[model samples]
Target: MALSLSARLPSCSSSVFEKAHKLTTQPPILPFPSNLAACGCTLLPASMGVARRRRQVVGAVEEQHNQTSVLAPKQSPSYSSSKLVLVIGASGGVGQLVVASLLSRNIKTRLLLRDPSKAISLFGLQDENTLEVREGDTRNQNDLDPTIFDGVTHIICCTGTTAFPSKRWDGDNTPERVDWEGIRNLVLALPPTLERLVLVSSIGVTKYNVLPWSIMNLFGVLKFKKMGEDFVRSSVVPFTIIRAGRLTDGPYTSYDLNTLLKATAGKRRAVILSQGDKLVGEVSRLVVAEACIQALDLECTKRKIYEINSVEI
Candidate 1:
């Protein structure tokens, strides 16, 4: 399954996966970042493969986004009726997969996205009962109306942006805003009755100033992400943060339809979930997604934080 994630991540799409920063004053030699969140996974419709076709150009290359059109279409995911999951950033790599996985499980899901129309193209049309789309941006508190959270039992916030500057930041959606402001607003907007909020954060969030992570933190993504995690921890909402390593799976949005349908978790099927930020290797989007869903039901995961990575072994 490890191989499955890496194998799928090569389609060459950019990450709008958001990150954040917060320079602490205590015992500060360099800015000490906070606890974390990060990337996610891909699960095709449990019955069908899956569909999220978007054309994107990354690093001077335009991926063949429609190659999958020639292939057979995948079915929507299945989820449970007893639970309602509100998925923020439902259009991202991890977010897309999380939605796909939820659908496969037959769970009722509501997606909060900038463009509600993308839902049709990404996850495919669904019964209003199974999937609902709300138009909103996390950065704006005005967009997060209280009614949106009314029936939401749980939430999976996979929202994020690239660590460095990219087109995804066109709207001034920087880590400071998306990671910090966006998350803070979302956390505050969440109903006190919420059962769980699974936050996907990056691995380096806890050590943005240390070595390699510092490189990625040149943009303060790790630090800002830490701030976002802090908000969730401080909020009354019960939550779990899943920090992912340098992501290495297809932004599947960039791959040919054929590849997505055939893609499966490779050798890296087993997952390693450590409480401290000790694991520093890459993780599969699959593992990340699985961890998010699993945490929703695991009592021990409540109010806890973990870093997730997957391996071939």
Candidate 2:
């Protein structure tokens, strides 16, 4: 869980930026202010200036769309009162951060991983009051402890393996196992009361082809991921599917958040950029965690699939 917080800064390089440029998709709708910083990303609204600016920009976009983007009301039903969230695959970069961010907000978190002890050293999480780690895996439904989901309101699946392995070897089979069937198994294992599920998925999975690229390429990835996405979409449960841009262990930087959602409202993509893999600016895993948490509480985020990448801040 602490590993999630460890990624917080920026560095700059043209090659990295070029890779970033090629990797980035169309931007989010509202252009984020240039002055915004990615540091302290999870708790931005604590600053009235940032909160005010966010409201103004979101309001502008909504007005332009002739549609409303409503957050759960101030008197919204206290789903947070459920107190616990079960984050599957919580040993990974995104899942670990999801756990940390939830715990940082004083929310109870039950992290499920294949090996809890392994994650202990990897995540550097020693905070007993804020976190709990359990041994489990998506492939083995029987391994999950039902008590973990007793009063849980939301679930996040960060189950897929990082794609670098596939890139390194044409014979790799991790993606098919982890991203495809593994997702189906996770879905089958969910509790009926679980209200929200957010999946961290990659962009271009729907585009890349398998010929020159390996069978594990994004296109190949998309072929399997799309199956999983479709399964989630068609399930009785509500869900949010996130197609993320290039991932980096980079520093936190300002990024415009949503694009497909913007385009659906008749707007073009807004160009956004975070510091690429360096300390100047980047997308913090912590921010992504918070965004997923907030998504569970917002009507605007329900039953929707959105994309996130660096945007002009």
The most accurate candidate by TM-score is: 1
Instruction: Quote model 1's TM-score.
Output: 0.73
TM-score of each predicted structure versus truth: 0.73, 0.60
* Top lDDT model: 1
Say what the RMSD of model 2 is.
13.4
Model 1, C-alpha of 177: deviation from truth (Å): 0.9
Residue 58, model 1: Cα distance from true site in angstroms: 36
Give per-residue CA lDDT, model 1, range 1-313, as digits (tens): 1011121211112111111112111110100111100111122111121122111111111232222221113443222368999999877777766776676567889999898888887766578998899999999999999989879999999989999999988998899999999999998888889999999998878888999889999998999999999988877889988888766663557232233334334433334455557667777675577567666765555787776665432
What residue runs in model 2 are displaced by over 4 Å at the alpha carbon? 1-81, 122-129, 164-173, 210-219, 250-286, 311-313
Residue 294 lDDT (model 1): 62
lDDT (Cα, tens digit) per residue for candidate 2, span 129-219: 5567777666555766577576777888877665655452343436667677778877776789888888876555554473333444743
Q: What stretches of model 1 exceed 4 Å from their correct place?
A: 1-79, 254-263
lDDT, candidates in the order shown = 0.64, 0.50
